[model samples]
Target: MVAQRSPVDLTDRRALLARQPDDPTVLAEAQRLKEVALLDFGIRDSVVASWLYTKCHHHIPTTAVETAAVVATGDGSCLLLYNPQFFVDIGLAGVRFVLFHEARHLMHRHLYAEQELRADPLFHLAAEVSINHVAMVRLQVTGLPSRVVPGKDAGTSHEPVGVDPREVHQRYADDLRDQGREPLSYEEFVDTDLVVYRELKRMRTPLVMPVGLCIHADHVGRHGSEFPADAETVGLIIGEALAEAIRAALRGNRLARDEVLNLIDRSEGGGDRLTRMWGNLGAAALRGETPRTRRVDWWKRWLADTLASKLREGERLVYPKKQGAVLLALGHDPMLSRRGRERTKVVLIALDTSGSMPDEVVDWVTTLVGQTDGVESHWLSFDGVVMPFVPGERVYGGGGTNFQNVVDYAEGRLAIDGVPFEVQPDAVIMVTDGYAPHVTPAQPDRWIWLITNGGDDWPEHHHPPMACHRVTTGDR
Candidate 1:
């Protein structure tokens, strides 16, 4: 874990960065790690033409992961240079935090939205002080799918982040070609109600609303997730408004001020915890003891314990399981085709028919069919003969087992069925007692050989990109 730091500003990075490291060796390692992170996220930063994005066809200069700051290209498609050394020196979690922070920039569409909102909404509320939380929330929700790059079939471009900040500058100039507009200063961004409401200034009294909110059914299926940051930002503003409204109601004799405060405190719990506090604040207000105005400190506590909790629970309504990348690809195209189109996915799982195998493995292999789990597992269990593992259009029943027939069957089907339909097999996971062939894929690009070494006849080539592993039926 990394020590949490104060909020940061990357734009004036020079002032933000206290010192710089100059070791060339450190810079090299930083660059390598940055490349791995980029690939893990599915970002392609190459000079080759993909027949995909036209703007990405040109040369992409080597990205420097060590610079505190660097240059950008004109088209917004190249990294040009960076100082990865700053990130490495900070430690990995620090790097992860920084990467996560930078990811928000790419995911939120902040560049474009900031330009539009600054030019429009800030004028509506004169002298506004923060980034427009309401607009930011709306944009993030609208753009979630667009930014995440669910899969190749999602049709979203896997563009490099900040190919060039200079392009951002150029875009700004182009957008301002009509000189009639004005950009809001950064001061207007940080001080606005967006920030103040979040921290709470108690311009009014707090409410007695319930501590808990209901969650959607779909949300329960996915993990309990926090609300989107932008949405949390909006919630703070609204919560502050609600607090002020409650104070108004009490002062106007709608309710006893102490009774309301008691209700709020009681909301922390119910039965006995709430029995005593209702007459405190409300009674004082009735006797004209104190005027209602914003109390920044009271709000700070309320916001963190109350409204802030709501913000964290925002995505409880999102239903992440249904919203993930798997379904996105299944529901769309280019990545999958039933008949014959572009690329086809063929799934083959190897089963060890060895004497050491257990019954549970057989049960699992049998039930997961019809491609419900997004795969048609071709299972081959080898005792001596190459018994058919995963029966395809070619067979209906499970038979004997043979180690060598596993590859033979796959190559045959791929050459036959795939050739006729013009599709290709992308993945093949072999779940077996590692007694099979020691041969590697001549066409290594199409296969992922995972040797589930049940009986310990270990195979050698199980390292990476091409994954190899052993799994017992007892251990998941």
Candidate 2:
């Protein structure tokens, strides 16, 4: 069973608060230490450190807590809590390490956000190990000096505190080797948060996490347990901060750049979430050799442009009769006019419901089309048959392809339950694998074909070329 720390008692908290010094000198020194840490962060990893400072509010609340911690305020901002006495005890290097450690915890929280993963004891241990390891390496510190207790001897042995990633890896390696299994290298052992958890779970006897080490550990009755509602927003903020650090590093911030790049290198296993976030953030510095900073997916950009163009309102200006008096006074012709266009564009989206279509593509397309404004969407999931669906409704099918059924429905030749499709759609977007025979639509110019991978694309080679673009699945 995992060891848990008892919650801070109210009486003890009150006592601790009462003993906290109100001396100007001590408070001033605490503020100076915080500033010094920030300056050091700017010198080491300029962009991210600066970004973190802006998002987090620093407080030196009187508490019995030994070290510093970071907690979310339920708003977009975070709190960096420290005890002035603790700072005095750990010295300047420890202060820097603790500050960096807390910042990394926030970063870890932003990255590995799945609730299942967060609840795992092993995963929590792995995260602490990884964060501490990164903090030690970046700050050039081997170990944290143990905090002094009031009743403890002054000259007692100063054992290093907190979990060490290397030690944890060694434990796993020894356990695996004794079981006649191959061991992963230290680098591979702690590669990702999930990897660490998975490997540790495989062991019959995994190392137990010590209590009172990780401040963010989700034990019962923990203080400052509230997390923000907008995790994506927090993640984006962190990403933007990392991006700024990368830019600063490129512009001659050597120490800052190196630190930022090292952190990025260590964070390799975040999968597509990390890739999509970092890919567009001018991450050439992270790659070391690649000078091509930004790498955005072309298809997404194209799709955005297409959607914008299609949804744009056709413009025509007219003078209102009420403004005629003002216009005449300004020596303009008194012509009561107005600007207007057709009602919301009716878009028929036909999904080829053959078993070959990817579900992810379908979901993405549906969400995109559904969310668009000034457009009335009519969804149809078709195989050899066509079935009409309302927005936010599920479409289930497994049949052969039939493009004619979609056209017939859009052209009002077919009716469902005695209700004909009376509205002539302004645009018809058909998402298909392009394996079936293609029939000419009634409005060929308004037809947009999004062909999937490895599917036959006949429209591209048709006698009169139509609006055809490959719909990228992004699976590759």
Candidate 3:
């Protein structure tokens, strides 16, 4: 069995948090509270959250946040920040609720990144409503955690508590009605997070503004801070976590199954990032058991995620101290400081281009590479010989397939059209029918093989196996 990692030491991670309380007692108490909440999750039926809490770094007594928030760190990992007094005031129940809410927020941010929806204050409110609604129902809490307000009852904050989805829906309905527009039913409104956002967009004025109440709302704009948390980094981290959760669920872990299902049901929507990741996950974990309607051609997603991992390996990314300080202060993830040349990641796509290869496959590859940011892509069409080409420009190759020629050109042993292939790619993707005799590249680990529908997957059975997946026309 693989050894489980020990929980990260908070002292080591505390440096990541800006403006941490100088008082050691306050820090220790906050750590105790955080540990208690995490322990509660472990003992309860929240394996996913428990696992996530263990995976993420945590900092206590952070003045950057009023309550708690999860932000991506500069190192492509996530950090949870919380105010010590807030946790102390809220008690254990509130601590649990807020932690769960922040966990859900991290998941939400990972799943969706639409600029328009993120920019809309209503959407942020809608997200809070949906997240809090789930947290309330799952945790069996009737009311939100409140802190003491001056001139009021000791556990009563005068600030509006807006956790209930139904209450938010009622307010939205009233506003829409006043504007002479129809409103969706509460059930319909709460179908999914995206659905809530879409319905909220119909309203002329939102009853609850999420600006000061939520961290995401406060840090939505650049305002001297470009969206921190490298999108790729967050995507990779969350994808791995979900993939692990899915594996645990599939292995008959009841709690894991329930949490995974809840996440997929509540957060997933058409054409979303999570949808693609889930498709690849379900396909891999469930194999042929996935339903037709939900079955997507997961190869593209699988390939994309695979390429990302391979390319990111062994790369040290850091941010400027000044910029990182500002990002941490705002509860935002700091991006790595890299020059334009250093920022560009190279990928090479080698198409078999034999008669067996389909047009759709090539088009899919073209679109995938073209859409990726900071990726300098090189294209090659290989038959018996290899020829360099660019996307959208057709190259003729009808001869027999030979994998060695492509590998030769990639490793700088062979030249194409008398010009030596000098660009060293971070990863190489070879799309072919896999009919040719397999020859090993110098670095087979850097290579990925895509076999066509009727093609053989020789790479998988090779002496040193390579990452190989079948390319389909579309969804099966």
Candidate 4:
């Protein structure tokens, strides 16, 4: 039997990236490729902005870059953290390769798992989509920007949708499979040979990559005993132990039953998928972070808004600083020196209780909030009107949630006494079913909504400036 990995040392996974040091040239190239991709594509740099790999040869049980992917998954969307540690085999080519791969995962909406995601067809499309996002971007940044992105889903009215994976033929990806040169991820580039010529190559390091990624942000006691489980090297290690998890799961697939039997067999796995899905998606969801160089408040507001904004339009949280510290608390000698300038915030639960609010859902909301720290919140229940209540304060109303009441209550000093709007809140955390006709004008900068879920679809123009996360009351 393969060893069970000594019960996972959470500290050890972190130590893997703990500074050993890397060549200056490899480091420079990775950042360079990223900036080039951004400038070229008009693709917002804020989306998966920078990446780095560990500088040393550390065996990451999995075949991935050696730094954790910083993200805003808790808010309901996909964002990426490209590793900066480089393995220069060909200049930044490998860096570009991985970026393209991960980008495919983002643009194509694989992160949600909100919908059914098959393994191949959409996966293949993700690869092609990135290639196209890059090709169009190159022309835009290097020379004249492209009026049209040559990508598969460029300039579409709706966000790009997922394609059926099983339908995708294998030849598409098989054609680009390593070309027998060895996995490109193992190398990095430092030189530029041809504008479009043959001698293009980068240098290589032994190996370095990241592992044990948690989709949601980890606050105080969310994970509980499983809080720091050692899934790191979980899928990373390549030993028989690693292969064992892989083999066991794959073995379950060996006896391909008929579609009817397979459909019936998926009940538990389906429930688990749902459980794994929005467990943190209730009223307490958040995207935590540290302060930036200066513009502290703006940075915090950006972090909050990005975290809470309705990500359907492509919102992403990109951390310029190191990933580990991004989620650390801010206190003395904290990440940012200007605390006042950078507003720190507590979460607010803005429930639309106008005639729109039903008693059952209200109890549900209170139950969810009760699960966590109750002090970090202010409750506003409104319908064709608005009323802000303190934690435990009681009030009632039922009618159309006049689109402006909740916003009015949240912004005015009435709800939160003595708190200035600027230094006011970090996030609004609206709990609505999206039935409201409209939303309040966002405070130029604030996380207006962190966890937005009710029972209906948001009106087209009713969306707020902040991230609008959607959660449902029923079964997944």
Q: Which candidate is the best by lDDT?
A: 3
**C-alpha positional error of residue 67 in candidate 4 after TM-score superposition, expressed in Å:** 14
Tens digits of per-residue lDDT for model 4 on 291-368? 122222231222232432322111111233443255343421112111122223355567765434455545655654
Error of 4 at 218 (Å): 34
Each prediction's total of clashing residue pairs, residues at least 3 apart in sequence or on different chains, is 36, 3, 0, 61
Could you estimate the TM-score for every candidate? 0.28, 0.53, 0.55, 0.37
Which residue pairs come into collision in candidate 3? none
Query: What is the lDDT of every predicted structure here?
Result: 0.32, 0.65, 0.69, 0.33
> Ten residues in a row with the worst lDDT in model 3?
1-10
lDDT of 3 by residue, 141-214 (tens): 77777656666776465443345677788888998999888888887788877788788878787455644565
- Model 4 vs truth, CA RMSD: 18.3
- Ten contiguous residues minimizing lDDT sum, candidate 1: 213-222
After TM-score superposition, the amount by which residue 170's alpha carbon in candidate 2 deviates from its true location, in angstroms, is: 2.5
Stretches off by above 4 angstroms in model 3 are 1-18, 22-25, 58-60, 110-112, 150-162, 176-182, 208-210, 220-223, 283-288, 291-476
lDDT of 4 at 266: 23
Q: Residue by residue across 331-374, what tens digits does model 1's lDDT show?
A: 62112111223222345555555544544544544554342333
TM-score of 4: 0.37
Order of candidates by TM-score, top first? 3, 2, 4, 1
